[model samples]
Target: MISSTAIAAPEIQHWQTKNGMDVYFVPAAELPMIDIRLTFAGGSAYDGDTPGLAKLTNAMMSQGADGMSADDISRSFEDVGAQFGQGSLRDMAFMSLRSLSAKEYLDPALDSFTKVLWKPDFPETDFKRLKKQTLIGLKAQLARPGSIATKAFYKAMYGDHPYAQPSSGTEESVTALSIPQLKKFYQKTFVAANGLIAMTGDIDKAKAKSLAERISSGLKKGEAAPKIPAVKRLEKSQRIVIPFPSKQAHVFIGSPGIERGHPDYFALYLANHPLGGAGLSSRLSKEVRDARGFVYSIYSYFSPMASAGPYIIGLQTRGSQVEEAVKVSIEEINKYLKSGPTDKELNESKKNITGGFPLRIASNSDIVQYLAVIGFYDMPLDYLDTFTSKIEAIDKPTLLDAYKRHVKPENFITVIVGGEQG
Candidate 1:
């Protein structure tokens, strides 16, 4: 058992380079390995008429770079036993590396990153192979009920908003993407002005600054990233049912939740834990899984984003038991909406969150990612410091009011794939 006592947030060093690149360094001498990440505001949201540009560009960053062959790039990282990878979500793409802090290992890794980011040699042969693989992966996703349900759910919830589009992109859109489109999108979005460089490990402030500058030097200052258009509110209740031959129905029910800066965020976070946010201890799991044994798992969560993110409750159950599972999920939601959480539930929830907070930032790579998010979202420097206290302050009545305001069962946009509407 862990104590609910507050843990101090780690102090971070911040600096800006000559080319307007914001850099954040958190020096953790505990480990001999250094973690570095470069994040740009290039994501699926930037996928224009040509979809998957952001993703494909990110994936191919190291396939060939600075006239280096794909084999050479992979071998260089393996030589030092370092890890290099890239990932993208709806809002940003990140290229990250973990390597030994020894000067011998460090310089080569930095040079490799510089080459990968500044001058990718997207060979024609590899591009075709990568694109075809992506297309095949997309087709596989279309065949799965879980994939179909999530795709349909997003479209229904976000409507015409760019957020409605799948991150991996549609079959038609990705199949048509040209090399020029990817280059144009990369040049536009990967500018220094639209990104942050974060480094953590056994290093002093000066070396970290130099490494950040060196890696980002090739990037010229450019315009801010293109903004995602506003998401129109989902007005009517929507139900999308797609038939598949799977034995279990994948059900996703949700509505739009809070934005990154909403004041109600802390309250919502606390309220959700007991409702369905906590894994085994969550209400949805207990009611739908433990009590009646209707399904294997039932869970709910809210993703707070730059704009209103979706509040989602998802479950998978036997096709014959789908209606029963949905009914139990609704019952739990309605009960929470009317009564909120009890004082005991609220106390335990806060206890678990505050206790588990430190583990969340225990690693250098973890801290780098957290710092990147803080810089990207414009969240306060002391956001982590104030986290526990904020959760501690929410009383029962306050949470009850929040539940009444936010969780509306009637407004839920329910989507079920591979199940019949009974």
Candidate 2:
């Protein structure tokens, strides 16, 4: 029952610079525009006791660099109608730019990107201002019930691991971080050897290669990244109930799931779609929202990362119904683990997953992202092309086996926020 939909993507060009910089490009001549993305291996995962190091480094890159004031930098980009932005996840930091194809503007935009990457000054004045703003944001998030619940969940699951550190550092941690610590972090991490550039838009092979070289010319190829130790596995189930004054009770139930490189990713991914990946049609939503009406919305997902990621099921409901909703959800999980999906459900899930896969790589920009990911994770060249076929081929028994091996409810962690009674 899987759709034989053919998924096509623009061919990706991959290469590496002499300085160990990986490069990926996808050409689209029609749009007089290009988007460039650079990613480095160290992110929040690299933050030592001085949490927020990676994020702070990324934020300060644009604040001032190469003797340019933050305002001057902003005005330079605004004059050309271009944008430069930065982001970080647990594993990598990303800096990207989008600009008009005109060389007069594009060259300067690229120059600004280079300046941030290679010559950021990390001005103490700007650092103080950004730190204050970051702390305020952190305090605001701590006031929310969902934030408290998630923080508690990570603490329970990851304990003192680097994974326990929130992407946005705690208020106390941010307030304690100084400009000197940020400088050392920048030197220790962000290096050419750990970085790559991904570009998409109007450019030929020669021009693209030259553009990459010009931007990365001054980068110092640094040492290999320090190895990140593997995440420790939890041996037993843990539960925490928190009471708060609120209209609804928020619940989260989860356990460690597959990593990005796990061989079972394809099977588990396909299996998850029918269970909760689909919106209204997914079993969790259908049972919890439509049939029983105990909750307004319910969702479940596994975020595959460098290490085992949290497999989570979350819901919000009337305070009095929290225990009932939790009971029903556990029952559903037990059933799914033991019996797996029916043939009809499996087929529909495959069809939806396969049919929708093409949208994931619909354009040059999309191809660039995929390329960057594949490069970062060292995935095979055929990953995008073979994705649909792989999903279509997953049978019921295989997925069931993976689920049984991975989803052990007894080892899961449950956190409840704003529920007076559990």
Candidate 3:
């Protein structure tokens, strides 16, 4: 068990701007740097008719804004010695900045960064180039067995749900994407009301507050996005095999897992740790890889999103050995399910997880990332402080029961890419 004094969560200060923008802050003056991340609603989940519109729109943000071209936008940050970043996912679109705390640099860095969120131009030239690049990426991804397997897995698991498509979208959908569509999606999603701000390192409350408000005010005022439609649970097990030219096969087995903050989340987390998430210490690695020599690597994880995300067990092996690898993997799952982790496994995992707690929040960027998740999901402020204790409290029966309820083979969606040629 972690002593209370062994770990302490940084003090988190949270408040909302008048316009409904959220701010989560932790002041860390030890470093001369500050990391700021801004997240908003409607990631790929809101792709609606177009599969990759949300991602494309996110990319277009840093290209140009307010008569500033991509080169100019990038150069501005470069000149100030600050780094700019942006990314999109199934649940949110975000922009991030890392800069020195000096007022001279922080002011202009924040200025340019703030402007890109609201004043994007989505220039025609960059749009064509970016779309062409996106299309090229799609072609490259389709050529790989691993990518094909993942794409098929999501499509099979979700089946026309908003989460069905990859964040990058398909080639056909991306080709047809237009600038007007991006503008509309941007206006609807990137509003002040939908935003959350997370800040860490080298700043006082006044500066954080002012920066949050300035960032919020730059965006158009609009309502928060509606809850994404629920994912439809699969009624039965299904397998999809797409034979590719590769000598190795990639296999993905999973079902819808828990959402963020599920009541039994910690139990499942510990359960998966020994089952597959603990690297060499995992059952999959020890039995399937070490003892049987069936797979190159095998691991499982629950990607808990705003909705129930995937609980995936992924592995790769020689095409001819695909059946054996999968059979062993499932056999291990059933055995583990029937009998939970041994007392030894549970205690070791707890130590392995709790031991690393300090390192997880050791840096400003790390905390900033956690802050983004906590703020976006409306999680408890003490979430970081309490994470290890929660893990410690979970026992074997609880972990096993949670796994049984959550991972049902009846609803498994398995996709295998590449196999022995028929």
Candidate 4:
């Protein structure tokens, strides 16, 4: 077990660029590498009438940009031995870069990165190919038990909310997207003021500041995107079973949970460990998989986004065992909600969480991502420093209160694919 004193938080410097972008910097000379992440409010929730527009727009960023073809962009980074990545989640879209801290490799890489961000070409041929590929992928997913359960589960829980839409989009939706729509969405959402930059490595404060400015200066000076609507409370329980030819059943149980920056988040985060978040030792895994041999795996987790996200318990079992598996899983959840975790369970959880904290920020890439999350969510700057202490302070009573406040077993929307129909 790791001790608290063995883990020390990196000193994070926070500031704003002249273009109104937020910046978080951690100056670490321990390595000759630097990692940068720029996050924008351009996720699927902002897709509006075009469901997969955000994801498509983000994916196209590196395909071609400015006057460079996709091959040109790839060769530029590969020649410098730098890495680039772009992705979108429910609440944010992000571009990341890892390069040698020396100006030679770093300068050229930043130029290409900013070009991709500020002036994506969205070549018609590439767009057509990507859209065809996405539609084919969506078609394949429709036949997958896990995919079907996931899509159905979100729809059941969110009920017409933007969160219900798939991040990759459905067949009809992706096919409907056009070059003009993609460009329009990109222009509106990928703006300077709508984003934050996080950087970590050998760079000093002066260089970091300049890097941040150079990254955002090319972005359109647009305002932040509108907030996602709050998730409504579940008025009734739903048990949806989708039939598939597969022999194994996929199960998803969840409802809307707390958002990032909620006061109760820490308590619930600790409380969830023993229930399903602790891997094989968790109650759900033990009860549903170990004790009964009903499933290959089972777990629970919260996907906390800018708005309230889903708190989910998921598992897969034999098609014939679906009913029994759901019954046992729900029973375990209800028991935990009723009595909470014991002192021994809570102590072990706290030890595991606190002891494991150092590994979460052990490298520049990890630090960059955490800084992105902190800045994007407006979390306390000292969040890492105080994380372990907060977990240690969460006693049984506090854990119970948080569980009671956030989780309601009766409201769970359960979706099972490849299960027997009534």
Better of 1 and 4 by TM-score: 4
Residue 232 of model 4: what lDDT?
A: 90
TM-score of each: 0.96, 0.95, 0.98, 0.98
> Who is ahead in lDDT, 2 or 4?
4
lDDT by residue for model 4 (1-422), tens: 55874678997899999989999999989999999999998899998777889999999888899989999999999999999999998899999999998989999998898889989999999999999999999999988889999999998999889999999998888988999999888889889889999999998999999999899888777898888999898978999988888888899998999899999998999999989999999888888999999998999998898889999999988988888989999898889988998888888899888888888899999999999999999999999888988888878888899888889989899998985531
Better of 2 and 3 by TM-score: 3
Give the alpha-carbon lDDT of every model.
Answer: 0.84, 0.83, 0.91, 0.90
lDDT, residue 136, model 4 = 93
Which regions in candidate 1 have their CA more than 4 angstroms from the true location?
A: 1-6, 420-422
Candidate 2 lDDT over residue span 190-300, tens digit each: 777888888888888888899889877878888657656577888999999888778788888988887776889999898788887888899988888789988878888
Q: Where in model 2 is the C-alpha error above 4 Å? A: 1-5, 420-422
Better of 1 and 3 by TM-score: 3
Every model: Cα RMSD to truth: 1.7, 2.0, 1.4, 1.4
> lDDT by residue for model 3 over 1-422, one digit each (tens)?
75643678898999988788889999999989999999999799999989899999999999999889999999999999999999999999999999999999999998899779879999999999999999999999978988899989989998888888899998889999999999999999999788799999898999998888988887777989998777777789999889798888899999999889899888999999999999987999999999998899999999998888999999988888889999899999999989988999999999888888888899999999999999998888989988988999987888899999998876789899986651
What is the alpha-carbon lDDT for the whole of candidate 2?
0.83
Q: Pick the winner on lDDT between candidates 1 and 2.
A: 1
RMSD of 4: 1.4
lDDT of 3 at 206: 93
**Tens digits of per-residue lDDT for model 1, 381-409:** 77767788888888888877776787777
Query: What is the Å distance of residue 293 in model 3 from its true position?
Result: 0.6
